[model samples]
Target: MKIEIGKDFPKFFKPLYQEEFELFSHFETTAGIPTVLFAITTWKENGKPNVCFHSWSCFHGDKTAFFAVMGNLYQHTHTYTNIQREKCFCINFLPISYYDKLIDTIHQNDLETDEFEVGNFTLSQANVIHAPIIQEAFINMECTLKEVQDLSGAGITAMIIGKVEHISVDEKYAQGYERYGKDGFMMLIPAPQNILTGEPNQSAIASVNIEKYD
Candidate 1:
């Protein structure tokens, strides 16, 4: 049997009317949301350091980037408050070797806990900013806050835009950059998945070669 809906058929017609979909649930069905995991470091007004794992981030322009932080949804969160006061941060791009540490840091909720000490990571001073960069990371970007935009009407989430002032790469990775033939010398990019249960799928690391087009 063959059935075809012609042009006369209504575009809104559905076989099941009760099967309504919800917003933000498309993460389960879609793929290819590149997750570049990094540690956002900031300093408090009292000279204390704070760090947190941020997977949702992207480049906005040649020298600008943005990351979404849900600090407005909760009180006493150090990442938002610290950035608000300091107006600068360092994004340290983590490699696969730091996967365990990243997971451990994500589970930590104490605002007073220093992630560098807890994750067994070292901090290196940024050249252009006061924020400390993760010494173990392969790449670091020192950025100054440029703008803040409300992502949601209820103020659940806000986007933090920053202008990258300086960038640093490890020496080994720097050599690998020219050769493009180093083993395990790539950044870790996880696949998007359910945020609550941390289940239903496995994450992946993405690495690709650049192909120039004419």
Candidate 2:
């Protein structure tokens, strides 16, 4: 037997359908999807450095990238405010070993404490940007702020686009870079579930083959 519930469906089920729709929307938006994470570094007017973890970042063009910062939550964050003042920042691609520290930086709210000290990470001077790069990171991009879009009206966030000035990669990972596009990079990403605790996981690295069809 086959039953079709079209526009003529009973009114009694309308509320149930609406409730399920909202739940689906929430889950789709908030579900922990795997994304490449970067630690962005900015410098204050006094030359103090601040770092923030951002998973909502991606390459925008051949020499540009964009990232979103939660305006409502990080309105007073040093990294957000500093970037506005300095107009430059560094994006550091951290390894899986720093996953725990990266999570800690996200939750930390103290503006006075430098993230490098708090996370126990060393910083090196960037060749083109005032902001320093993480010494331990395998890759670092020095960028200048190209644009800042106010997305607060739609969602309490701001989209920051930057022009990549320079890119530094560890020599070990740089060998035969053309052969391996992104698979050669070793970085942490969100996991579907924890293997040990069965909780929402956070750190995992996987490689996938790129298939092209003409």
Candidate 3:
């Protein structure tokens, strides 16, 4: 069965482009689903600097966040420090197919260690920031922290709202790219879902909503 939704902006359902689409299923949606590793580097409250590697992220569209933290805990995060000082960050999303390299980046690399050097990845300077970009990944979002909300005043994990400064991606991930289309990119849906329905609808629904506000 097929549901006729908007195939363009201001429509109810959005058709997925081959490269830049995710699904909206009850079990697993694309909004906040994907495991990635990023290098957390900080300048410092003092005059020193440091960096570490983390394997988690729950970001939002430059205004809200998808993070969930328990209690007050903000001491040893290099990412948080960088954002606090520079007011910017770059999140690089990786495909789970590169699990091994992702794992390599999750360890306690030194302050000046480069994850791309250890992992099977490439680094490129971002379009709008001084931070490096993951050239091998499917998506890279350079964002500025608009706000950081501490839920319950517990600093364990603050919901960071970032304004997307810029976005760079592979041409293959383009929405109209035929290669990542239904039969093109052999990727895991990441859940039990309708391959055609979920992803396409996500783009469609989002497009419709954007039009409503615009």
Colliding pairs, model 3: 6-13, 13-204, 14-204, 17-175, 19-173, 62-162
lDDT of 1 at 100: 76
**Per-prediction RMSD in angstroms?**
8.0, 8.0, 12.6
**lDDT, candidate 3, 94-179, per-residue tens:** 54445456657557345566556667566676788756667865677777667776764544555556667777767776773432
> Which segments of candidate 1 are over 4 A away from where they belong?
1-32, 60-76, 176-199, 202-214
Residues 106-189, candidate 1: write the lDDT tens digits: 676466666677788896788988897889877788889887767655454567777888888878778654323223323433
Instruction: Report the lDDT of model 3 for residue 173.
Output: 67
Estimate TM-scores for all models: 0.68, 0.66, 0.52
Can you tell me which runs of candidate 3 are displaced by over 4 Å? 1-75, 176-214
Better of 1 and 2 by TM-score: 1
Backbone clash tally (model 1): 0
Candidate 2 residue runs with Cα over 4 Å from true position:
1-33, 62-74, 152-155, 176-214
In candidate 2, how many Å is residue 69 off?
A: 11
| lDDT (Cα, 0-100) at 40 in candidate 2 | 87
